[model samples]
Target: MVQKRISEAKEGKAEEPNLLQKILSMTVQERKDFWDKQFMKCIKCYGCIDVCPVKREEPEELSLSKWIEKAKVPPPYPAFHLLRAYQVWDTCILCGECEETCPAGIPLKTLQDITQFFSPEDVFELVPGLDKEIKDVILRFVDSKRTQFRRVTYGL
Candidate 1:
């Protein structure tokens, strides 16, 4: 079945709705509301994290895992989900087990599908205000570099 899907994808015969396309079609406010609703449904079960097969294995000194406070209900908005989402981006195999185990039926598979639409840098956009801040920082960096290049090339 997996091979058949791959062959169908290569032949452009796959009829499934593209997850990235669905997400991109939404307005910014819609995207925010979508994620907010999806994440708020989490019951702090940690099933998603538990089912992750390639969780970060870094030793203590090099560990960068954002520790989730399991005791809190709803797990403080996106923090809990964000950490898990980022961790699974490169590792998720699309097995759907996490979604199956989630008692609240939070679509772990669909949430993880955001990786297809976003790179790590743009992932911050899922949180309000962070997207604008990231854009500003990138613009400032680009402008500063352009100014430096002009000064060097044209002796401005």
Candidate 2:
């Protein structure tokens, strides 16, 4: 099935739009509505959280997980989702396991892809002096101009 679609796309015979193009075409309000609907459907199963490999873990002094707050279902708008998104921004491998494990069918992969598309150089940029070593590495990367910014940092 997938090979046929790829062949048709190569031959310019595929009629359906790609997911990224479809997402990019949506108006801000439409995108918000779409995400809101999906988020509202979440049952707070924590499956995505469990499957995510990038979730931040504080040092031994602090709690095991400090990034994701323990909130109620429907998670007070985008807080839960955004926290998870940002926590995984730098390290997400796009493994699709989160989506696969989600019982609510929240389309975690699609949401994560959109987040990744917009992710900045450092996910903790706003937090001052968090990881100086990594920051120095990134600065070197940027100054060297060895590759495009996204390619160097994100492997895009």
What are the per-residue Cα lDDT tens digits for candidate 2 across 11-79?
678877565444555556666676678788887777897877766662222221443346667664354
In candidate 2, how many clashes are counted? 0
RMSD to the true structure for each prediction, in A, is 11.0, 9.0
To one decimal, what is the Cα RMSD in angstroms of model 1 from the true structure?
11.0
Give residue 46's error in model 2 in angstroms: 1.0
Clashes of 1: 0
Q: If scored against the real structure, what TM-score would every candidate get?
A: 0.59, 0.59
Clashes of each: 0, 0
Question: What TM-score, to 2 decimals, does candidate 1 have?
Answer: 0.59
Question: Which residue pairs in model 1 clash with each other?
Answer: none
Candidate 2 displacement at residue 107 in angstroms? 1.4
